[model samples]
Target: MEKVRATRYVLPLREGGSMPGLVEADDDGMYVVKFRGAGQGLKVLVAEVVVGLLGRTIGVDVPDLVEIELPPAIARYEADEEVQDLLDASLGSNLGLDFLPGAFGYDGSRVPDAATAQAIVWLDAFTANVDRTWHNPNLLWWHDRLVAIDHGAALYFHHSWPSRAPSPERFAAQRFDASTHVLADVAGTTAVAARHEELAALLTPEVIRGVVEAAPEEWLETTADLPDADAVREAYVACLGARLAAPAAWLPGADR
Candidate 1:
């Protein structure tokens, strides 16, 4: 991912818990910045990049990701205390998604094609993402195209890392409940099952490692179990690989 410095703080996008802010970067492009010091911690950022790369690997319409450098001086002129505190805490590399100007939140009015819908559902199911429900569709309608966003909630298994060790088998065996998934009805679990191998083939071991590597080293939280960033990346690769290897265990059997 390309790295850019934040030139200006535009505004706080206070929608979700992370409260990603809108900021202009040195490249003269605007991006939605997900802070490293957000309430969700660095794991959210890791999930965002990892899942994002995976989604794009299989041809999902996701935004371009970049590393936004938050220099100390960038927050000097912030007037809002809350926003300033967030900026102060997030004083280094943060995740930046290309801001699609004029993009509106997804509504049932604009539907994705069957192939796209199934791809989205399969990606979410494979990643165990539970946040793409109707109420919180992490999707956007951009210029008549459906775009995927906000994957910070996908890899929930990592949150358990503080205490438990990374368990590939467990995550592999974890069932993905697509009942609340926004594209559940549209994608239909049957088609998702049919395309399992076809989609899974897109994420080769090299591809998985490449996506995991996209995450900045600073963001990969080092637990005692995983001593270094590379180890953590390996752990992610293992978990994802295990899940892909054991589809029957995790793939939703029907449209529930």
Candidate 2:
């Protein structure tokens, strides 16, 4: 794992959802840091780190993410001189990173063409991510590439126990049923299937292992102990393969 220079700075983006801090690191450059506030338990943080690793290994264009070690005193320093100066000069609230300096979305007048849209849909289905939609796309335009952010919802509601009986209400554990609009659109678009197959090779056990190995120690202890890299890869491959083979009438699974 490469060493990243961690600089502590309050983020200017304030989205209503996750309260993530932004950090400019020397290794990965810039990253959105999700704070594990008192309200958030270790599980959520684990989810973020694990999902991020898996997403990146599969060739998904995810933003650089890292765990920020904040001091207890820093919490009360929300009114520090530097922090106050940042808030006053910034256009939006610095409460959290809903917005970033150079980050922007696709033009409202021109949604992604069928190909790109379907690509995203296919990836989301494979990951069981329910957050992507017309509303908060979580898709950003970076250097002419579409990037996904704020994936705090994928694989949600999973059973922590190995022998737990699964139920219909078990949203996270369920496989992707093809009937969903996202799934239908994705399959119908030839571009998506072709791209999916091309990228399939990247989603390997070695890839998953690399991501897990690169993750911070605290992150591992939180999310089901990293699921053996091979197991993780196999699970994703099985889910994606099944989704691809399923009839189009099935509904795509939910993320949260």
Candidate 3:
């Protein structure tokens, strides 16, 4: 639980959109460092950290998301050509995804069954996450299980319009996709079958509260003034409840 500090050395990483220089830290610990001024809000970083921590608790696979405090005084680019090219293309933009170096995709042929997809859909819906589609398969295949990644888009679009109603598009779309696949894979042992009980047992109200509570208060402060801290906490619970109440037989945590 020691917080890792960001330092001067840069390691090359495959570039992600909206940012430059996928570099590794010098501290010997592995992490993708997104510098502070890198276009994204602090909340996105907080969301990645919070959601990642929560997902891991219930058996979901998420990359380790951590914040690296880069020194503004440090000269930005290094001499490395690959890293330099990426930096040049993405100059003045603020954001970076620490690379998940050495991770590879699950064979496209072994596409996930509907049941596990159901769980993924449900999880994203519950969290109000906006990522996860055909374009960027944030779902990584590690150890024969679908690992979730890139949640900087969750609980989003709500920041701007505090009173805005939630959109069901992402939830509906994922459910539709999962249902079709689930039926197709009825013969196989789906992921939900193996871990639904554990996920259910772990996703208690307390666990949800702990993650949301740990979210940076500054992010909340930027939003419309919630009546009080409890009010903010209650809102997140309501959002989670809506997704959980949906009938998802293949949902890993639904029955438990």
Top candidate (lDDT):
1
Give candidate 3's error at residue 256 in angstroms. Answer: 20
What's each prediction's TM-score? 0.97, 0.62, 0.64
Deviating ranges (above 4 Å) for candidate 3 = 9-15, 20-23, 76-99, 111-118, 142-145, 162-198, 218-221, 227-234, 245-256
Model 1 gets an lDDT of 0.91
Q: Stretches of candidate 2 above 4 Å error? A: 1-7, 23-30, 38-40, 80-100, 112-116, 157-173, 177-196, 221-256
Residues forming the 10-long window of minimal summed lDDT in candidate 3: 175-184
Task: Give the winner by lDDT: 1 or 2.
Answer: 1
What digit string (tens of lDDT, one per residue) describes model 3 on residues 88-187? 4332322334455556754356766655664565555446565665555576766666777767777664455356544433332233223332222432
Residue 124 displacement (Å), model 2: 1.2
Clashing pairs in 1: none
- Cα lDDT listed for each candidate: 0.91, 0.48, 0.52
> What tens-digit string does per-residue lDDT give for candidate 2 at 187-238?
4644555566554566565664554455445433223533554444344334
Candidate 1 lDDT for residue 99: 96
After superposing candidate 1, which stretches have Cα over 4 Å from the reference?
A: 254-256
Candidate 2 global TM-score: 0.62
